[model samples]
Target: MALKSEQARVLRRRVLGGLIRNLLLFSGAFALACLAIETFMVPSIANWVADSTSSWRTLNSSEQFQQILTDQGLLDDANLFDLWVNEAVEGGYTNDAGTITEIQGEVNEMEDALAEYASMMADSPENAEAAAAHAKERAEKLGADVAVASGTNAAAIGDASTFIDDATALDAETDNARAVPLLPYQTILTAEAIPTDDASAAQAIAALRVSASLQELGLSLPEAQTFMPPETTVDAATRILVSAAVLGYDQPTLNDLLQSAFRQSQEQAYSAWLDLTSAEEARALGVSDENPVWQIQYGEDGVYRMRDVATYTFVKSFKLPLALLVFVAGWLAIILRALNRSLRYFDELSGAVGRLLADKDAPIELPADLSIARNELAVIRSQSLADERAAHAAEQRKNELVAYLAHDIRTPLTSVLGYLDLLRETTDLPRETLRKYANIAYSKAERLESLINEFFEITRYNLSAIPIERETVGVRLFCQQVAEAFFPEAAARNIRITVDAAGAGQFFIDPDKLARALGNVLRNAVAYADANSVIAIAARQDARTTTITVANRGREISDAHLETIFEKFYREDRARSSKKGGAGLGLAIAREIVVAHHGDIEAASERGVTVFTLRIPTQGEEIEGAAAAPRIPGATEGVQRPVEPVPPRTVRPASTRATSAPPSATARRGPSARPIPQRPVGERTQAPRQGTSPLNPRNARHGQVPARKTVRDNDATPRRRGLSR
Candidate 1:
């Protein structure tokens, strides 16, 4: 299927456009779900999609982390380092800002604690007082702090209905510059000297400030912790416990320290496991439990050291991409199916074209989508069928013409036979009687011969009806000769004939066939011209064609008859007898020969003048109808022809049928298409009557001894030799 044809091009473009549109639409929808619409989801579906597929990675990482720990003899039931590190690192998420702040806080606290502990260990009285004053200042600061707000949900900030008016403001942000308060003046922070024996003394010094602050709020320690500043998790808790025990801590304080130490130990072990792989090792290895492309999976190597995304990467999911592929593939299949179905309409067209000549009456049908092509095909079929019906009608008319011609031949033949028999039987007949008998017999024989010739013309009206040989001819001479050929018959009726070939110099045409065509027209005109009426023959030429017209003055042919006058076997008056009526093929055959040169003929009658016009193209083309499949033994039955109420009633159709030349003086040189009013059938045809019918012996001008004579065919075809132009 070439894309050049209309149907193929239409379907191809449509299918391609559909596919492109579908792809673009699908892509847009996918992008909307991923970029625009997904943001409104509660969990942020990206997080869901991004995190949901992490289970396998998590398991793999946990195993790999454990393997390293086990290799280092650090993996034990009590430690469970992998779990510790996973939580501490917040599901292994990088925490660049949090890590910096955590390490800073630890450093600040260690500095203060060590300074106080060193002063107490110095055992100097002033150093101890200064330390006591410092502790008193810290307690006073703690006491001035606001009490912890009460609430179960941390987001509510201690009250379920707590309004966050500032947060709603567009420019809202944290107040990073908190004011550091000065200590309030105290009358006495030291009620007595510090006790040396009690293990609670150290704790008392450290805890009393926070405890006193809590008592001021009348809240328990845990409750006060909400308002208190947050502390980072301390590492090496066991060392802190050992040092505190050596400083004389009792069972209760020791128990608290032991518990804190136990939990911190687990965290410390995790920190140690991650520390096993240094920054160097981290960059080199492609581990099993890593991000896609062996990116860092767990906390740095195995330890829980917070880092940024630029350093540590995570795993990815393929689900969304896979789903997109399936979506596009399925749509592609649907597009193919739709396009495939459209091509089936062409199949319907093929079948419909094949059935154009079938003997069926049903209309060809197609899908609504193919309406344009369908309607056009329907028109073609209608024309073909109409031509078929007309052909049949033409065939029927041919048979009728044959029967009528036979009858006509019989009339003349019987007369001739009867006249001859009378002459043969009467031995002593009078000289004048014998002369009359001979004249009658000769006339009948002539009529019979004319009828036989007409029949022969009809038989030639088929696929190979006539062949043409084109040549240049003198238009003036041609028109003059054709007009002069009818002078005899024209004179017999006192009808004058004129030729107008002005500006019609030489023209290219088929001389013989074109002459015959012109002769037929002139003959018809002469036979029907009014007595003393003028028959004018005109020939002219333009750039492309040569035009000739023969006009006679007589009774008018009705518009109805004019339409069909050029069809096969069409008679103006069928009742006209052998002597006056034609088989009706003269004008029709004239038209055929003219059309063969790629031109046309037309007739018009108005007032009392009837005219027949012929046009022949300067550049001839083949007449397609002439060489068409031979008709069913095609005879121009209306021998001669009619347009069969066909040819759109526009003069005539281009057909392959020919016409028979009946013994028609009516076909002679006549403008008579309508019948003479109430005239007898065989009466001397008047008011457009036959003049000196070459068929009727009484009407023919026979020769005297010294007179030169002219003989002509029925249609005035110039068979005369040595004829002067």
Candidate 2:
């Protein structure tokens, strides 16, 4: 394809690609925004719900039941019940105390008899009968006391084993009194029992109390006997009746049966109370009780019912911290996922770019399976890659354009230089000599035109201009023609030029462009050669390529200049020495041409020899056998120089032929692009070697003439003055 066309495509793609990339980046940013919303918004609501559920404790089934029971009137008779209990208790206490006093008096009498017996035993050492007799009397008195206590108290002292701590601690007067369970419920039971009169009810209560005391105290038969009154012996019939009443067996009094039933009820109630209290205590202590609530039932019939209560069990749901954790966790996950995906996309992009840079020819393949492609990150990456490709292509095209310009321009310019040289050498008559000078003037003008053209070409490449044009050509003829064409200039400076070839033949190239490329190398050699120095030009071709070198003998250039010698407008001798030449565009143009042909050129200077070598690919062929045919050997030599047609008026414009001769010391120094400092005209007192300093540009302008330097005295200094333009 044409370089200009390719360059246009490259620029368009670059601009469009940039716009697309920007759009992709925007899309990626939007994806990131969505992720942010997910991370921050939804979980806050969930947390609010969780926090509000934690404060109040709910009631269980048992507690609710207890409340219902409290609303009923079953427990309202307590006051009346207490009143009845007090009256009954007073009468019982009085009767019991009277009986106890009688028993005590009898016991006291027995104690006296016992004391007397002890004294008799001590006095009657010889009379054991006296001691025995006193003891018998004490025994009879004790028996009488027990009978009396029992008969009066109206309660049987069942047996000695039945005695309790309270019964023993009481005085003899109070010992016979009835004992009842100390509880508020006792009053309720008492009041509920109907009595015709207060006294009768009191007697009934006293009997019931006596029965309760006998059973709870566990009084034995022997103990009962001691408390009995003196004349109240407990005979078989009386014993039977007492036994039946106390034990609540056969023939028991109504009060006795009620007391037994009451005792049983109290015991059952106590057991229930213990169980309920234990369960409550466990729950209070933070232990899990099977039943955490208490149930209580009160019946008008004096029945109290208790049961294990039910508990409401549930997990504490309203944890502020946990709720906050859920909210934060959910948001954090979203944020992390978003950030992670972004980072992953960046990583992939970086890798892809690295690989593309390493190998531009390879196609870009990305891993977009991570949901990144569906997101904005993918778009950004794709855009970036597209931009990169466009830039790469544009850059490539620009370089190729530079190459095409340099090669094409140099081709015509070389022919013009050669023709001017031929015209100068062949003409001798006065009019013809002056006319050819005009021709030489035209040649120099063409040279400047070529230079300007190459300059713009390079500038365009640097700014990303047109693409390259390439083709194949024979290497042998290309190298020979370029070398031979510079032969006249070499001879003018007494510099010998040689061409050596080997191996390969043809090269893939644009011939006109390549010829100009080779010309630049020769030009540099001619400008830099020392007087009588051999400027060797050699060409070699291998399976892969051909290398043509133009070398000159001169002072070597420094490493710094050698590196940048091919740069544009690089003139080695800027301060016109005695042998200055053209503007510094030769090497630069040469380098561009070589590149356009898909070749390369390099410069090296060492040991007084500066060499510029151009390497271009070639097809297989013998080297040196074929040499470039010289510009149709001079017209007089029988070398049938065909008559050339005159150029059309439009083709040969007068303005194109106007130019001044080259300056004197236009030396291509070492392998440098920058011009080297030259010896001033005043300093040229010493003779310059043959090829080192050519004729002065001023002298050449006036007439073709040369001069030899003259040295005066040892310390003589020449007067310095600027040369004429």
Candidate 3:
């Protein structure tokens, strides 16, 4: 089954979608848990605790307390009211005493002012009545202000003069009152109260003196109230008794009586209040305690408090367990679902790999599902199958190579032995016959040698990297030498070979290695090129690269063969029996050499013409001690060699030309032969053939070729052969 493309895309989307969805789910779960804790669980717990505890001694029933819980939620609002109540209760009664003290102080100041004004009026009887009246009005106004501070009615100011007289008499009577011990009462009053401008100092002093007098008599609250003056109103007597109690004058006894009475009254009032607001009663009031709301706490001190104790305590008790349960359940479901989908695919892949490993010939079987195509296991399976196929093909090639080598070597060995045996057995044969046998033997031996060398060459290339012994060589001269060496062979085959070395430059190369590599290409060209056809050899150079091309008009190589033509043991002639085909190692060896020098070689064939191109770097890597070599003449220093002059070519048919001029520095063929242009060294030039000239006449007219000294070849070293693959 074929893999589905849409399925693969869908699988990717599903994977990413699953990841994102799971992340959101987990995040959402956590956020919900937090929200529940903050909004519901925490508040519920706080409300429950508040309802359960006593708020009568604290402030759970206060308006501020209820508002805090309603506004801030239960957890933050907890215990807030208790804090406020404690503060208020500690200072409440003492504040009242301070108010009284302030009012009395203001009244005393008014009396002193009035007394001073009256004395001034007495100095002048005519001004006496006016002064007295002014003083009285001033006194009345001051008394009214004092009355407001004391929490007394403004009507009390009507008797300001009389009140002043009584105050003075009281002050006189209290002169000896200071001698009495009242340290405990004073300390209690100071702690409870801080006198302020609003309080009546005169009233506070009177209350203090009364309390002191009562303590000296060791009277109870009732006994002190009874001793109050007859003219004193019930309100005045009650204030005296309360102040005495606050100042620690018979404090323990008075506190017990007051608490008992207060408790009795508060218990009745609170019971009635609670009944009115009970859950049953709340429904009638349109207030539902569907959640049983606040607990009622009534204290011994007659304080009533209520708190919410059900909602928070019940919620806090179960929120975490519920949240945890939900989280675990969700995660488990996700894990199980993921495993259900993935585990089977993984298991199947593992089994397939195991089978393949166990039996080398076993075919790999993978799921057709495109969802699994991008999985690691699937990739490994695919690669393993491909490697197995490649290994099988390679083994078949190796078997064919061994058989071909055996036959090729045997044929040459048999010929050489047979020729030598003929010479040995025919002693009476003619000299020419003897010579013929010897020559045959020698030729066979050479063939055998060439075959052996080919095997060695393959082994050498395969064994390790090929090292280059580099030297500076004139590229143009090198091409000339190669062409000259092949001239005799080409003449024998009725084929013409031409060399074009226009604008070729000096290059650093391993001369022997390069020669061998070039020989392989030339040998292939010579073997396959049609008889009487031109095989063109061209060499040129540019700034960085030196290019050499061997082109011939011959059988066109197929595109498939052209790609693998340089592969070891690969031959276009699949028969492996062609006499000229030497084990198909020649071009492969050439490629190895060129590649080792960090260069490239390629082959292309079109319209019965095959061309092999080699491009090696001109400024190749230098070996140690090779930098100081003398430069070639007519070769530019640190630059490409200039194009040499091209002598006119003599065109002739293939049959008419017996000898060719020691081919020109830039050679071409036929009537179209012209001076080849000088191009920058390392520049790539097209492959040369019958009709193509490197030079353009228009370019030559423009003086593209620079005038320079002609280079002459002076080295007369004899040419060596047997380098061709």
Candidate 4:
């Protein structure tokens, strides 16, 4: 239980440690990822925002105008005004040749009128004096009118010529301006041909006003009309003259008018270009009027240009999210690897446990990396092996017990069968001989009965604790009485028996159980004791214990055998020869009985003497009523006849009836000279009388012994014997 608890604690600690380690690792990785994003990615995006804002702030109005011109492709090296004029002519916005033709025709008409007036004056001279006065007046009026009209026409023609020359010069200037790729806003002023030399700001303003008026009038003309009505034409000419007078010439006004016309055309063209180019398309080309990154800067040439100043870096677009993705993937992989390892560990452990449970004999194997200190598998495996060994040992002991019982029972049975067979076959035998065979057979039968009873005693001892009948028994007297039962057998072997009970007192024990225990010890002593050697039985007591020592001069038991002498089925004679040794249960049974009385038994042997000591705890509490003590079959009760030892080589004279022998004969021949009586062939023996010793001379002398008639002396046996002979 303690081992299992410790293993559980170790397992918990290992699991907790793994969890903490994984958590720390994940946290550390996440922190590093965040740090990288902050350190590298953040600055890049911030710089892009700052540059974009600065780029937008740098643009001015002139730069914006140039940017629009550049986008429309109008600022190219080609002559912009010439191209405009060509486009205007194709679309019929102006008719320059028709205007020149109209002016020439007007001059011709003035000349024709002056010639007609001269002819009228010459032809009218015939009307003489009366008509002279009228003609002269009309002539003067006509001439004056012709002169005025001619002068006005000639002035208009000169103005027209001047306007044409100025336009040609203005066109040349526009062509020059268009020659440079980056023309300035001031270039447009040059294209207008406006003379700034010696011009006052006020005079320039007046010139601008007159030029704006002329441009408006030209724009209002219908393309299909080559000439205006006479009144309208006259008014237009008067205005031109008035603008020229105010500005001192028409050239400045013409320059202003041209500049205005150029601007209007440029704006219209720029609007068309804007409509075709989307903001997104403009950014793709690296020049955006909308995006702040596409900034415009003014040069010393007074020209405006666009350039890209700021560009987005890769870090701003990709690094942070990419780093985050990498971190997540790495963390997931680590987690999966840990999960796989844990799963494999559990699989191995589960498989080992399953196989072990299926077959207890199977070997337990675990993963190599499993920690021996923390794992319980090793401990469990060792315990299983120990249990298996213990089970095997128990099985071996059981087999040995069965074999020993079989051999012991057979020994007594053989003798009984031998004697009984002899009686059945012999014909005309003497009555004494028949009685002798019968007596021998009966003694052998009793021995067999005793051997069988030992088996039962062994079974009872193993099943549970034997109920002990506690009583006050005289220790000295009990030992003496038990010793007396073995005297005849000891005497038959020429072995001496002695009892010593000095300092012994009445002991609280189970009397019948103690007697049985002592009988077993005494029987063993007699069987193995050498002839003429002494067997001693002594009882001693202390304040707490009563000790009985039974010692015999016999074959010395080895030190190894002595320790196991009281174990069931252990014997000094391993061969288990029935004539020389018992079934090895006697001492074991004795030990059981002693233990049931709260006592212990031990054995020792040295110097050719073997001794068994039985110690009972006399001071312990005694049980009041115990179950009836087990009766050992064939155990002597009243007047027990001592078992006689077999001679080395001797046949009995068959007439000895030991039970019927007189007390004087028994006393003279020694106690074993007579046999105990046997029952008749069909009759059962009566219950043995209690409290009467079979060896008592009084009972034998008074004829209190149960008797049986000799079978060989009967008439029926003789008749049967005669027929057999």
Q: Could you say which candidate leads in TM-score?
A: 1
Ranking by TM-score: 1, 3, 4, 2
What digit string (tens of lDDT, one per residue) describes model 1 on residues 236-293?
2222222232233333444443344333443554454456554423332322333332
- The regions of model 2 sitting more than 4 angstroms off are 1-192, 195-315, 318-466, 577-581, 596-599, 617-725
Lowest-sum lDDT 10-residue window in model 1: 644-653
lDDT of 4 at 120: 38
lDDT of 2 by residue, 205-324 (tens): 433343333322333333333222222233421232233333333222323433343334544444544565665644533436554543445544334444333321122244445555
lDDT of 4 by residue, 89-185 (tens): 3433233323323333332333333234324323552222322233224434333211111111121221222211222333332221111011121
lDDT scores in order: 0.46, 0.42, 0.50, 0.47
**Selected candidate, larger lDDT, 2 vs 3:** 3
> Candidate 3 regions off by >4 Å?
1-21, 41-394, 425-427, 468-472, 576-578, 620-725
TM-score, per-candidate, Cα-based: 0.50, 0.39, 0.45, 0.40
Better of 3 and 4 by lDDT: 3
- Which scores higher on TM-score, 1 or 3? 1
Residue pair clashes in candidate 4: 432-654, 432-655, 433-654, 638-692, 639-692, 639-693, 639-694, 640-694, 658-675
lDDT of 3 by residue, 266-362 (tens): 4554555556645644443243455555555665445555554455556557867987787778777776776665566567666776876787456
Each prediction's RMSD over C-alphas, in Å, is 19.4, 22.0, 23.8, 23.9
Error of 3 at 278 (Å): 33
